[model samples]
Target: MMEEILYLGNIIFFIFLWRIILQVLLSVIQIFLKKDRSSTGDEYHRLYEESIEWMRQESRKSHRR
Candidate 1:
């Protein structure tokens, strides 16, 4: 019957919505815990900048040779 089909559809929609909400909640919890694992902060960025600068210097030296 149409009524039964509508009820089933509603249940399916609710399940899907709940799953999406739980996934978002889990992701937030994971991100909160992930930050505790590292204390490096902006050090990785500084290292990257230093490496790039070194590469630029090497490139310039090679171009002159």
Candidate 2:
């Protein structure tokens, strides 16, 4: 019946709404508690150094031009 279909739709909607709320809350908590670990990694450090070297080279080239 139409009423049963409406009830099922409401149930599905509420379940979806609850999932979204929980995801938001958990993400907020993680943002407050989490620190970025990439900067601490060796790969990140190497990349940062490479970027700095590239910038210095570019500046030198621009100064010569």
lDDT of 1 by residue, 22-52 (tens): 9999999989877854545567778989999
Give candidate 2 misplaced runs (Cα > 4 Å).
35-65
Which residue runs of candidate 1 sit more than 4 Å off their true CA positions?
A: 39-65
lDDT of each: 0.90, 0.89
Q: Lowest-scoring 10 consecutive residues by lDDT in candidate 2?
A: 32-41
Candidate 2, residue 55: how far the Cα is off, in Å: 38
lDDT of 2 by residue, 1-65 (tens): 99999999999999999999999999988876555554457678898899999999999999999
Q: Model 2: C-alpha RMSD to truth?
A: 8.0
Clashes of each: 0, 0
